[model samples]
Target: MLAHRLACTDPPVNLLSRVQALMVDFFWDRMHWVPQSVLFLPKEEGGHGLVHLAGRGAAFRLRFVQRFLTGPADLVWRPVARALLEHCGGLGLAESLFLMDLKGLRLNNLSSFYGGLFNVWGLHRKERPECCGSLFWLLREPVVRVSRFVCGVGPSLQQRLCEERILTLGQVVEVCVGPVWTTLQAWPHV
Candidate 1:
């Protein structure tokens, strides 16, 4: 209910922070010491992850733009959105909204709106790239960076891995568990 209201009106950053802070405080009071980074992790990674509310709200706003673009002609908002898009020309709904700078158009803050738009479009960008039957390609599919998979693994480790010609997660797994495992384990940071 609160989110729905927030979605309509451009809620302030302080309000969003307050809500997140309250959630954190509640968990802290219960003796749950989960890290913020861990909270953002996927469930498969063993964290009780929550979808970002701002992202969801941005998606909701974009849904309106989508409806305007693809929805039945009978709908009232569709015509308005279509007219706006036609008037703007070339620019996408998200871009048009930013360019117009309409005072009445309430997007739940700029960062959330942009983040949501990226989240929606980024998925499509990832899916379109064809993996050409390569094991390394498949391993690199989910994440473009190794640091995202393993928390606290810094740029130095990444550079070392690259220097050793170790690229994908599959390679990392093979090296860590294969005959080279002992040698890798004997390395300074391992």
Candidate 2:
């Protein structure tokens, strides 16, 4: 319910803050000497590992945005979302979400959501070839799964590739198909 409300409306920050403060005060009253940070620490570190609601709320909002983007298109709400995206001028879903975050606009705002989506769509919009020609098209295809190409690479190596900003098979093919093969060989065996 809270997640739905957040996804639909921008709730007052003060109300949220006050609720958080009250919870903190209640905990503090019972354990006068316990540092507030202790509540947030991992259990292995001798703390309760309680999540702060404001952070959780922010995470929920992001998750909601992600689900709206990646969720099944056949969902009942998908048409509404698609219509909203179309009305915003054909923006890609993720791009629109990113722009909303960048502009400090509320994710629930249709204008911001649509604007960002349109911006992404505009950036990636390219003339479709009459037939698939070069492998380069695989890189441009938004729905292409990179995992199929990285099947044999260990998770650690994949993490390294991600950390280096080599996110796609196209990028790996471009970067690793050269002298980078030596670098790959040098990676320590797991």
The candidate maximizing TM-score is 2
lDDT of 2 at 42: 80
| Overall lDDT per candidate, in order of appearance | 0.51, 0.52
lDDT of 1 by residue, 72-179 (tens): 768975554444443332222322232232333343334443434434543432222443664433443322132234646566775576467565555566677764
What's the alpha carbon RMSD for model 1? 18.5
The global Cα lDDT (0 to 1) of model 1 is 0.51
Model 2, total clashes: 5
**Using Cα atoms with residue i matched to residue i, what is each candidate's TM-score against the true structure?**
0.39, 0.44
Off by over 4 Å in 1: 30-32, 37-51, 82-190
TM-score of 1: 0.39
Residues 1-190, model 2: lDDT tens digits: 7656544555567987887787777778756678889978889999977667656655555555556666666678667765665333223333222222223223344664343343333344245555766544444332122223345546677457545655444455657475444555777761
Which regions of candidate 2 fall more than 4 Å away from where they truly are?
1-9, 30-32, 42-45, 89-190
Ten-residue region with minimum lDDT total, candidate 1: 89-98
